[model samples]
Target: MPQTTVNLRSLFLLSPDVIFLNHGSFGACPREVFTEYQRWQLELEINPVEFLGRRSGELLLYARTALGKFLGARPQDLVFISNSTAGVNAIAKSLKLKPGDEVLSTDHEYGACDNTWELVCREQGATYVKAAIPLPFDSVSFCDRVWQKVTPRTRLIFFSHITSATAVPFPAQELCARARAARILTMVDGAHAPGLIDLDLEKLGADFYVGNCHKWLMAPKGSAFLYARESAQPLAQGLVTSWGYSERTALNADQEAYAGRETFERRHQWQGTRDIAAFLAVPAALEFRRKYGWERMRAECRTLAALTQERILAANGLAPVVSGDDILQMLAIPVPRAGAERLQKWLFNERRIEVPVTAFGDMAFVRISVQAYTTQAELDALVSALAEFYKDKGNS
Candidate 1:
């Protein structure tokens, strides 16, 4: 698309009045994909019995196959989940975390995921330790820093492929290799990865991974997936109760990773029935991305994001959260004053610029996420709003 045709206003379903700069929190569905999603919903509503009865299985298979191809995963190994939290919850809850077994994860994990691990570990008599990766993170040194936390009791290493608050891409390939060598379970939270990062599930080499399609993949809300390595599938279980399960009568494929051992039917696939349209729309999202040249499109998005990061930080006298290479599509920088939340509120109320100003650790910061539909002008709008917010400081 031409630069002008890449109008931020037209490409997304965002409100005409709001300048949306938070594509990272929850993805902004493109107008075309949103239309397709609505169409699928309408089709399902027209004949709930017929659509979900005879054709639901087939429809799910088609979407799964298409999404698996997009992620370079086998359809059978991937299961649809509402989001990454639920996906990881299914894995974490099913794991047999005996006493003295430690689940080492980074401090940068999303709050909800941290709670998920805490809840699961508390019940299973396991320890969940936060491995602090010093800020201004150097990816080459990240593995060693995290490795120092590991001990003979360390049974699993969990971390994010892209940190939600920090927006740093942790070097997982080397770390997963080390964990595999030690026979330690390796799982990752990849919620922000798929479309933002070049993903080859086989290459990531984690025992299990889950990410959101609604975030970077631009799918409708509630569309995401969990990918478990074939060897690790036995530990899998559904987080909800459902009829998809075979009772005590196990399927031909059964093992000890916990899928059969836990309530996979009741927990995961049988989340009781809601809108299947969002999931059914995943293939359309994948196809739209594929046909639209997603790879180059992602690269362009990174370029725009980098430009925004540079322009804003330079104007605000702040530093880049991490080097351009280490971060993905989002950048997190410390806010100039106390109460980043107040600044977030001020920015929105005064400027109509919908951006994120979140507090992480001791520092208050703004996390900026850039998407393909975004333009330099929108980024400039954000900069102007922030600079104006602190206009008396004369930084801009």
Candidate 2:
């Protein structure tokens, strides 16, 4: 671990007593970023009309520009959303589906987004096909498995860039290209990819890519984005029709003579008069990470996560879901069946360690997230707690 990360802990507001191993669930905002968030909120309160009505559009565009630069996207193609789930819903709801049409995805997708597709498919009389790609597989093998499930009925392909519970990285770029070759639309749920990995939306070539800034980017809550390729913009519609709809149409006509009238960002940017402080504070979050040498910190965090996974696997006699090189800042290790929740509760109550013991099908996993604030001592405490818990279970 980097020595600077120990000092960087003071930059966050996390409790000193609790070992926070769940940065993947919702990221902890740094003090500077949170201050900027509050400053925006205070500015909005001082003069609501001036802040929201007169100045919000320009401010939002500026923030979006900064975020676009970070993600390697065009400012016009990206729009702000509350989270990846909302982004997925926007794309899924807008798609024209019919009976016998299939939306192909993997079993490793996030549960909430999976529900969105299922509900949309049910309403449209379409089929949601979940391809079962087992772990410990290479990118080529996994892509082949998912591609084999596609048929003439498959209209769309959706999967996570990095899975939620399992923490596996899928071959999204390769799959997207294959889907394009087959004339199928592609959507990528990149909820955990933004801050964890370097992103280039244009090069990745997904029709729609959704990522959360709050999770890995160190941004405030309700800050996420959706990037739609130019060709696919017509297929996207906002969940709620608002000011962006007619306003953008007129603006597009004036600016480009209706040349770029069909835009996804314009259709979804303004949903209502909501508190957009989080969205506006994205630049601050980006600056904070840059000032703190986030790239090096991320590398250190990945090393810490791999070390922790090795220690836990050695102690528990468990197999790894993927190779050590595949693990990033998060790793999910299998635990005893029916004991995951018990162990999670015990770690929280006994050791004040906050981590997720997620259940996926017949298996239970202890997912650990390593961040700049995390330390080896905290991880050691968790390992010690788990050792005690298993010893007690053996005696009982």
**CA deviation > 4 Å runs, candidate 2:** 247-262, 394-396
State the lDDT of candidate 1 residue by residue for 60-96, as single tens digits.
Answer: 7688888888888888778888999988888888888
TM-score of 2: 0.95
Model 2: C-alpha RMSD to truth? Answer: 2.5
lDDT of each: 0.78, 0.87
Sum up the clashes in candidate 1. 17
Q: List where candidate 1 sits over 4 angstroms from the true fold.
A: 1-8, 247-270, 392-396
Instruction: Give one clash count per candidate, in the order shown.
Output: 17, 0
Structure candidate 2, residue pairs in collision:
none
Give me the candidate number with maximum TM-score: 2
